[model samples]
Target: MAAPALSPLARIAREQDPDRFLCALFAPAERREALFALIAYNAELARARAMASRPMAALIRLQWWRDTVAEAAARPPPRHEVAGPLAMAIRAGALDPADLAAMADAREAETEELPFPTREGFHAYLRGTAGRFAIAAGRLLGAPAEALPGLEARGVAYGAAGVLRAAPALARQGRCLLPADLLAAHGLSAEAAARDPGAPAWRALARDLLDGGGLAAPPAGRLPAAWIAAALPAVLARRDARRLRRSGLAAPPRPGRPLADRLAVTWAALRRRA
Candidate 1:
């Protein structure tokens, strides 16, 4: 007999974020759908900002997801494909609505023209959204409470790297993610960075951001099997951060061949590395 088809949420996850989806494969089968659902929902939230043509459009779409989360809180078995599975994960993982809601709230920053006013502000934004997602993912993966700080750091690294990778695209949209103080310190304006991504000042700022992005050094020894799987994105993020610094925004890192990425994750899981 043939294998069953993936649900809508699973396909969203597998198609939109193959790296994290590949890592989730290490999770037990019965729990995999919940993981996919959580990731897919996050992708949806992210896409709201990525796909919107205007800030108002992004706000409208984000509001929709926020409302969906509210409705899901009031009632189980949400109506949409992504929401339904997300609701299940919420219940199964005992996730807090406030945390999920905060993720949506933080995404509002993405729609703004000048989002990160300061370095500390940028870090706080990342912690609220990406760091929060890591905590939620760890909970679903059955991570111990003691492991959360590590997971949160890993998430911050991935989130910062992801944002830095999107710098070119964001620049084209006439928006910048770099902190205002960093841009000022380098004597580079957002317009200048957007217009000439290859400029020396812009490259210097990118290198600085990548260096301070909170990408923790890999653990010296093996981690637990579950954590190793859950932290795979951080591994990929570190590679991306390095590439972003070396290559600049014009040549951000690619996801690489899917097979290679999956193999690397599998090796990491087997060896219990991040």
Candidate 2:
């Protein structure tokens, strides 16, 4: 069967996750739409949390996605933009409803005031959400269970970097994803750090998390060549994490920086670094 047509959610995914979108260009031509379906579905769930003013509001929105997935499982695809194409991917065996639900459930943590109490707690959250997303994408790209441990490592690294990079924006929304213990160790409060992104303690903490938290490691072992393209975004994540360590949580570079980032991603894909 042919891949589903690109939906509006595909545009949102391209805008929201340009790195992965760029990397997806390297996937087999026919499978690219399914990849976009996965990315778009993820973007839709993430937007649910970002747009919510309260945890309950976010939960309500997330539940809609959950129920839609369930209904899609039982009968027909939901008529919504993201859900329909997502259902196409599910039927094609490129998407898993279980992983979709897990990602949505894990994202509820975004609505909480202090989502992660410890570094390990944050890692667990990343594993369930972003890490799971990576493994699913890996499977779509034809990687097996043996490849998951490495993919999970890349996922956690990329997810943690993304959280750190969004610290300022998250702070504005009165949410903090940084582990409480890390902030405490640095004698920093989320409010104070948010107000002054260049604070010494914030820099120290950022540096430690990016450098010592295993965010720098590339994926290990032999992987499907297609998986290198799928995982190449983690290389950019490492680059951004390192930059955040030095410069603190400044605004991220605009995505799809075709000249620099695409070249970098291409190089990383060739090298099979992640």
Candidate 3:
């Protein structure tokens, strides 16, 4: 007989985005599954809030996710289908409840209009959210907490780069992910920043933020190395940003990396985890 149907939560964890699911490769056994599920829940909640719908049900569901994650229980058979993997992982080892709460808090902030006034503000948001989670993941992999700040830095940098890489799509959502004031302080508007990011003023802002990301890099050869692997995408985005003058606000298209290749990366990472 066939196995029971996957719950809505499990579907979010396993079937939402194949690319995101594939990122589980970077973590060890317990944390990898747990992280995937955590991110899945987050993505589902974020998607729900992106509000492609006019119905009240969507808002109600969003509120439920907000409440559940914001108040995750200490003991559980697993709260929801989405949080179950994390629950199991937390039980196994090193899933600090604070780390989970921190992430939820960040997402809650994201649901509101952003209030970043400077590049520093952008960095703070990135670090508080993604950087913190990456640090916790590094810790779960047995890296010390002191080592986390470095990894956290890389995570914040990467989060910024990811936004830049997805700038076009983000703009489509009516969100300008770039810290515009960094550009505006030098007399650039959002339109100007996006139209020709290679302009001296635009490039200056990019250069500053790009350089700031260097502060976030991990210690050389620390803990399985793959934990720092997300750095590659950020590095690529920075290099491309230098040439972004002609492109303006347009984000580069997703690179054509194949599934088989990603699977190979996953296999290698898992082997290290083992």
Candidate 4:
């Protein structure tokens, strides 16, 4: 038989945010659409800065999403492909408006086009963006309250790895997400790193961040199977970190091998560990 058609949000999730899309497939059937809607919503926010004509325009786009989430509880969301289903997820109490708003709020930093001021600031950005998303997904998947800490830790690690992976692209855009202080400590500046992402210094810097960025796996037993599914991006993060360690930041980041990702995610899910 031919495959069934994807919903609009599902198509967006699969195309733009494949890692989360893969993980969402492990969610219960009844909750999968809501998960896809949430991932599509995030993908939209992530692209807002790049899609805009200027920084101000990017901020305006983010504000529109923030307003949409804030008003979703009281009125119908704008007739947007992602927004409509996201609002439905919120209304059904499967997604949290506050968390969605925080995720959007975190992206506001991208409008500045500068490196993060401090390591704490960088981690905070990760916590607010990816961390919040994981928590929301876990809640939708019925993760217990106790799973929150592990979920947040793993999410932050995934965010850190993602920043490293996107370094080259961000450089091309005249932006750098690495902490300014750390860059300076390695005798590199944001402008310099942005100009030469392959500098040997960047390799050292990438290692420092990977070692200290809390990419360590969380305790195995703390999360349930559903929570593991929600935090599967962490598994990918670990794999990326390993590759970065082996090849250094001088190498361009490559797309994850689909079969390998599937096998790893499937193993993690079946083992009930992230």
TM-score of each: 0.87, 0.89, 0.68, 0.92
Which regions of candidate 3 fall more than 4 Å away from where they truly are?
1-20, 45-48, 52-66, 70-80, 91-94, 191-204, 212-222, 225-249, 253-274
lDDT for model 4 comes to 0.81
lDDT scores in order = 0.75, 0.76, 0.54, 0.81
Model 4 is weakest, by summed lDDT over 10 consecutive residues, at: 214-223
lDDT tens digits, residue span 142-235, model 1: 7899987888888888888777667766777787877888778888766675567666666577778767544443453467776555677777
* Residue 25 lDDT (model 1): 79
Q: Which has the greatest TM-score? A: 4
Tens-place lDDT digits, model 2, residues 131-195: 88887788888877787777877877788888887788778867788999888888877776568
- TM-score (C-alpha, index-matched) for candidate 1: 0.87
- What is the C-alpha lDDT profile of model 3 across 60-168, one tens digit per residue? 6656655554445555645556666656666666566666666655654445444366676677767766676666666666666566766676566556655555555
Model 4 clashing residue pairs (backbone): none
Taking all chains together, the TM-score of candidate 3 against the true structure is 0.68
Cα RMSD of all models vs. native, in order, equals 2.6, 3.3, 5.5, 2.0
Runs with alpha carbons beyond 4 Å of true place in candidate 4: 1-3, 191-200, 219-222, 252-258
Question: Candidate 4 versus the native: TM-score?
Answer: 0.92
Tell me the lDDT of candidate 1: 0.75
